[model samples]
Target chain A: MRLVLLIFSFCDWLQRTPVASYMRASFWAFPLVESLHILCGNVPLLVATSILSARLAGWGLREVPVSKLARGLLPWAWTGFLIQVITGLLLFSSAAAKYASTRIFPLKMLLILLAGTNALIFMRTTYRRVAAWDTAEVPPLGARFAGVVSLLLWSSVLVMGRVLNSAVSLVVAAHLWFAR
Target chain B: MPDFLSWCQWLESTPMSATLRDSLWLFPAIETVHLFGIVALVGSTSILDLRLMGFTLAGTPVPKLARRVLPWAWLGFGIQAATGFFLFAAEASRVYLNPAFRFKMLMLVAAGLNALLFHVMTSRSAAQWEGRSTTPMSAKIAGLSSLALWFAIVIAGRMIAYFE
Candidate 1:
């Protein structure tokens, strides 16, 4: 498709950038940036969002109002997400074409998009009525559904991210095995 | 040190460890569980830490919040310990040689000790200040230290592969 070609061209451009070249050239840069990505972005984002989801599902933290928990925690979730976007982009730029071609990368991105859409729909619908059962031990069915779905989606995204890393190693291992 | 090295070697030869190392799917599967375990563990701990620091959910008493969150943290801890042992067993000899792995172990001990100390010292007096929006200075210090140590642990854990 023309769109796919366009996207690949964009990836090619990104991969050719000076920053991308530096990321590939430097030994410490990739790992250090990756450590930062996991620590700052993935960890906090998953934690905050998981806690929020848990609360929505009536799994824990029953005393705190949902709104209060969301208010306190959503900021952290957003902050983590912001960091994820920045770090993810930086990492992607280094091997844009390869990442674009990878199945796992697209899968991870799709999971993220679905997670975001789930949150958006929840906020627009069930969450609009949060006041009704904000402190209830069991939130409405819709909120709980959203919560469970979000948890599974986000966790899958995490797994896929890890899988993406391992997939590369697997390829290298296969190459080595062939070489041997 | 020699005794430890031999122990690691023995672990590496065990049937369980051999299975984990040989299987393509098993290692990644367990590692994925380990990742989720971290979410539960660090996620619960951070919630409590944030509350203790008067950052969030101040309206809820500390004891009440602890009652709600600590179980999940313990569950997460149990998962981590179990999965971590398997992971260590799979590559015990090599991991023992890894500086990052060694550092992670030290950080884990320190983090555990920090938590134990908080429970013994600061948390005993939690009842007195549980209602206040601002926690005692000691509690804040404990929370801050736990957060820092856990983040360090995660970073160190990630660096294990890089080091190897």
Candidate 2:
């Protein structure tokens, strides 16, 4: 209950802030911000997951050790993940109550959390043993599992994002009909 | 040109377009698929471009990386093209006239040309620098151009909604 109250107060405060109003009122701000968010947010996730998964599956990157590839690619992934959070929060703040009501919104957050947890686990467990199979064509079972999980979770997050739009529109339409 | 736009208007008025425009689920669902294609296409191209630019995966041969990644890139482009057609068909008139849409189409053309020129000019002799730490200047230029053009296409694509 306290958590819910804290959320409500935080959202209320966010809605009253200057940034939220500006985002909502501006004609191009929302779409442009959303563009940046999706591009920066999902692209890295896709790229990192795809390449890492391929490396894990022994599909490519045979010459370079897996550790080197991961090291090189992870900075971009981190950059993207950070951008997503910032832009996503701004977008959400512009319509907090509306977004909070949408089912897909929570699912999207959950997916992101799951993806993050999966990455952390991978880093801690399979990735710690990188020296053993760094150049092996097929990575060990755990690393492969983490790669696949990351891919699936991120993909679902994309789907959830798209669905959020539909869910919001449906809710709005229903509200209009009921009010009439 | 008027005739072409008129044809677009006609296309937009079709039942299929109605479903895409009016049905909330269908539009976003198709758009999600479109995003998937973008991820696949752009994601793959970006990696290959980075490799060409001598940024990452230095141990992997250029030709080998290209051979692995380009197919996925092409597949993504193909998916985008198919889904894009459906999307354009749904809002043909609006998209036909939108400046952002026009910009996106132009950038896509530029991207295509850049890819083709790279393939014909630079990539033909990829074997010479395949394992080298640094690529030739021409390869670097092509890689840089590809990176810039594809990202421009992405920005232009996202602007379509705001402009419309």
Candidate 3:
């Protein structure tokens, strides 16, 4: 109710900003930013996270200590995450209201939130005990569980993000069919 | 060129292409899979590239890392090729004419050649430098060029949509 209204108003305000206007007006800005988002942002973050998660699950790289793998990969993951945040904000600003209204966009955001939460919980809990099983062929149950959930949630986020564009077309087609 | 264009036209007319183009869900589904393939392909390759450049994972032997990581890269490549072929089939003629698509194909070839040349020339001496902190100059060159080409391929692939 009030929260939804606040969100919509915020989106409207965002869409009216100069950054949004510039994003819309410049022919190359949107696409170029999107390319950067996909290449440097989403890909690296997903890859680094996936590798870490896979190791946590005792899937591969069993020889490398979990702490060492995390040390090496977390920087890449953070860099990618930073790029994603900047580019995502730029993209959202371009059509904030429309994106806010889209079902897929909200869903994508929710999944990302969940993924982040999963990572945090894992870090605070099982990951704190990583030294006990850092090089184990099979990690503890908590670590493996966290790894699997993280993988699924992040993959869903990716799917939802990619489907955002096509989902709009599907909605339009449904609307047209109903109108006819 | 004319023959290639005709072949593209023929591909566009095929029933499979028509089905993919007409269906809203199928194309997006395949495209999502294609994105996953890119993640796996580029992700695994980048790990190895960073290692070869002595930037990260310096302690791991080159052969050991390659043996572990290259399988995933090959798997990703298989997924990319299969999905990419279907995607190309869906809009063969238009994509054939697309400059971005053409550039992406060129980069893919270049990336492939770089990998092959590295395997043939640089990696042949893996016995000599497998555990060294710094890789040979040729390996570093191959790694850097590969990273550049793949990133270029990703950009070009994204541009195909905007160009269209």
Candidate 4:
């Protein structure tokens, strides 16, 4: 597995992003909304990073606790997710007809799945108890664990998103270069 | 700019990146890891920053909160530095030629330097910071800059695909 991954990276590394090949610069909506998608997707990312980083540093959620902040931030994060999913789909639609065959596409979907499933688990199991944490004062093994997992999963998703996009861009550029 | 395209073609044809590109999935995988680190860096620091900026928790020492999140942020930076270069190496001249790419690199430098200034000039004293958590002006400036820079980087990164 490591060997295969290494080979792929090497190939990918050799391939440039071809950053300017097919850009029409004519469309407004696609670029506008893609900007939004990228922005919004970052919301959950920021919150999750904070909660988890707090844990990694031994602060746990006790200082802020979990239930309140999680609940408060949940809507914003979900809003971001919704934007990402919707806009992400549109962005994909712009290129979808051929993106299906790429390896990075599968990786992107899998990372999203990992993040979503893990997030669901977080919302369902540990978050329910967040309200009771400050007063109840539990040691936070569960929330800590959840936060750590959230960080790891989200991070993977972020990387996958980038790699997927980069690889896809490379493929598109290659196609254009060849067609030219 | 035809010269630039020729340069990219030449760069891609070279045995160095070709061998590495064909041989190293480690680059992407580490990049994957770096993404996680970056999210953590943003997430961890923002939580504290938000608190300092009057968003999340109230009444905690600002310095203490900063202390807690700071290490994680640094760790995130470390991971980012490692994998970020590989992402660049995959296509340096390509990114190097784009305006958006240049801006992103500038933002990266600005963000890093801003972070340093915040720590050096504006960090709250240990006494005022740890318990009642009042963020110094410099820290807030750093946080806002950091936020803007990272977001810009992400946008530019995404825009790299769309750039002409």
Candidate 5:
């Protein structure tokens, strides 16, 4: 837990410090980066969803060999996640002081932590067993569980990301209104 | 101007329905969960959807991809179904009244019933189209509807807030 806090603190710092001023100077690129992140986020979401619906009808990936499908989609999702993190940091850096004091900041951290943890578990527990599920002619419950967890967590992360800005604004608005 | 949507607002805020109003945060959180679930869902589904739209995996059999990825997809759908019910629970009255919500439900039903129809139609056709990289026109239509209806469902889901 301490280690997790420590890492988040460091991220909190970089996101605040604008330590690499050059990154901050490249401010014009933020929207482009963010849009790319949105694209990455949306496309995979579409694909991953339909797959789940088909499966519930008692079909496993082996029949259609979706193991590689897992492999195929991970990179896209990861790439999108990476872009969000980078640009997110950049946005944070541009206005570090304000966010540092905001409750919204911490909430973002908790959600990001969940996303990262979900990703790690996904690769280790779920992605690791694709071939075995294919070879054994049985879908491993562990992998399925991991898949379920991943689906839930990433969905949270995306919504959290989308709402983070608005939420912060809303909090600020409520604060200001209440203060008056 | 929008009488129905205004009715939705009244329902959401009914003092007698404090139980529902007090619980807005919970459903949104569940939605957050559903959001992630769909990520995994789309990841698995797109492979098959695209396959239905005629993109084939090299060497690996079509059934094989379907078998492997479908669980991940349905796992998402399952999470969605569970969470979806909660979201409705949170604002059941409002959702029941909103036009966008109605359309969303219609699209969901369309997607669901179409999915069942596709399965029945395709399973019979499986022997003929089975393992073939390219799907028949009907299967492609199924693929298209699956994609389109879900797209509408998501957009409506997202837009329900805005429209209301």
Candidate 6:
């Protein structure tokens, strides 16, 4: 109850921010920034994840050391994530109330949380043992499972993000129809 | 040009396009799949491009890296080509008129050409540079050019959604 209130208040606060309002009102700026967000944020992370996931599944670039590959790519993923968070927040703030109310929105967040958690667990456990299978073509079962989950979760996130607008419109239309 | 626009308009009016546009969920749903295609295509391509640029992943041979990622890249391209056509069919005339769409098409051509040329020229001599972190001048330039062009395409793609 208290926690839910705090969350709602935080969302309200975010919605009221100047950046949020600006994003909502500006036509060109919104789209341009959204494009930048995808380029700088999602693209890199997708690239890193695809490669890492592929490597983990023992499919691609079998010759490269897994630890080295992770080291090389994960930084780009982190950088993309940071950019994504900022851009995503700005986009969300543009219609915080609608987003906050949407079922898909929470689902999207949950999927993201799950993806992050999976990555964390993998890093702490299977990844810590990465040195053992650094040169092996196929990673251990745990690592492979993490890879598969990461791909599915992130892909679902992309799907959810895209459909969010339509979902909102549908909800609004339903409410208006019922009210009438 | 007017005929072409009419043709596009006709395409947009088709049952398929109508269904896509009219459904509350369909257009955005296709768009979501389109995005996944973009990720797969661009993500896979970038892996090879990065290897060419010698940015990272030096331990792996260049040819090997290319071999591994290119298939997925091709798969991504196929998905994008299909999904993109569907999206375009739904809004054909409008996209035809959109400067962003035009720019995106141009960039797509450029990116394709870059890849073709790299395969023909720079990648022909990949054997010499396989194990090394840094590629030859031509390969490096090809890689860098590809990255820039693809990034431009993504920017242009995003712009299309807004400008149209």
Best by DockQ: 3
How well docked is model 3, in DockQ terms? 0.71
Misplaced by over 4 Å in model 6 are A169-180
Chain A TM-scores of each predicted structure, in the order given, are 0.94, 0.91, 0.91, 0.72, 0.62, 0.91
Which of 2 and 5 is the better model by DockQ?
2
TM-score-superior candidate, 1 or 5: 1
| Candidate maximizing lDDT | 3
The order by descending DockQ is 3, 2, 6, 1, 4, 5
Residue-level lDDT of model 4, residues A11-92, one tens digit each, is: 4433322322222233555666666665566656456455544543356655554555555666767776778888776666
Model 2 Cα lDDT, one tens digit per residue, B1-164: 35989999999999998888888567788889999998899888988888888887777788887888889898999999999998899889889999989998998899899889888886557668666777788878888999888888888887887785
- Per model, kept true contacts as a fraction are 0.55, 0.76, 0.66, 0.41, 0.24, 0.83
Q: Could you give the CAPRI-style class of model 5? A: incorrect
TM-score of predicted structure 6, chain A: 0.91
The better candidate by TM-score, 2 or 3, is 3
What lDDT does model 2 reach? 0.84
The local distance difference test score of each candidate is 0.87, 0.84, 0.88, 0.63, 0.61, 0.85
Residue A94 alpha-carbon offset, candidate 5, angstroms: 14
Q: Which stretches of candidate 1 lie over 4 Å from their true place?
A: A172-180
lDDT of 2 by residue, A98-154 (tens): 888677787899988999899899889989989999988788899878877877888
Give the winner by DockQ: 2 or 6: 2
Cα lDDT for residue B47, candidate 1: 78
A1-180: candidate 1 lDDT, tens digit per residue: 999999999999999999999998987777777877777787789988888898888898787789988998788899989998998888888878877787899899999999999999999999998889988988899999999999999989989987887876677577789999
lDDT for position B23 in model 4: 59
Give DockQ per model, in order: 0.58, 0.66, 0.71, 0.24, 0.15, 0.66
lDDT of 1 by residue, B9-64 (tens): 99999999999999988888888888888877887898788887778777778888
Candidate order by decreasing TM-score: 3, 1, 2, 6, 4, 5
Model 5 Cα lDDT, one tens digit per residue, B1-164:
56755665565566534563476365456666766665666556666777778765545555666777777778988998887766665565667777778898899899889878987776775666555666678867887788777666666676565445
* Candidate 6 C-alpha error for residue B86, in Å: 0.5
- Residues B17-76, candidate 6: write the lDDT tens digits: 998888867778778888888787888788778878878677778888788788888998
